[model samples]
Target: MQCMLRKQAQLWEGAVLTTVGASKLPKRPKVLVWIPEIGDEAIVRIRIRKQNPDLATGDWLLLSRKTDEMRQTLALSTDKKSLRFLE
Candidate 1:
């Protein structure tokens, strides 16, 4: 089966070739990103602030863990309460 994990966000990193969908919270959804890590692409989810137009399956977003949350809409949410992987 494909990997799925919920972890805290780090710096100097980002995700692409992504898909966004409903998360535990109706507002901030889980995102599927192909991240290059440890010589492999680890599928990671970094929760974010709600989007104007929420992303759907096959939708693409280039998010950065290092970017300022307010400045970068794709910046990962640091709120411990809102971080998780879901449908």
Candidate 2:
């Protein structure tokens, strides 16, 4: 028998303003942040894996900036929630 392991992708560092439930999909949560390096305020949709109670508005985070095939939108890490609260 062969054993295989999948490695997790690295995420970019960033921060969020607030976390709000998506109106279309209540289960999905979205966040707002200002990426001065990229531009002004940008909205990032998040998929929580291991919920962190400390996660809140105006906190630093680790994000994944990978985009879809079209390369239009940036998405969070797929393996796990890379978001880390830095108070």
TM-score of each candidate structure, all chains considered together: 0.16, 0.18
Instruction: List RMSD in Å for every model shown.
Output: 17.4, 15.5
Best by TM-score: 2
Candidate 1 residue-wise lDDT, 1-87, digit = tens: 133422322322563334566564344444433333422111232222243223232233334543232222233322223332223
Itemize residue pairs with steric clashes in candidate 2.
none
Candidate 2, residue 56: the lDDT equals: 43
User: Which sections of candidate 2 miss by over 4 Å?
Assistant: 1-41, 45-55, 70-87
Cα deviation at 44, candidate 1, in Å, is 2.3
lDDT of each: 0.32, 0.33
lDDT of 2 by residue, 1-87 (tens): 123111111233353335467775433233333332342123332222124444442332335453334333333222123233421
Over 4 Å off, model 1: 1-42, 45-57, 67-87
Tell me the lDDT of model 2 at 53. Answer: 43
Q: How accurate is candidate 1 locally (lDDT)?
A: 0.32
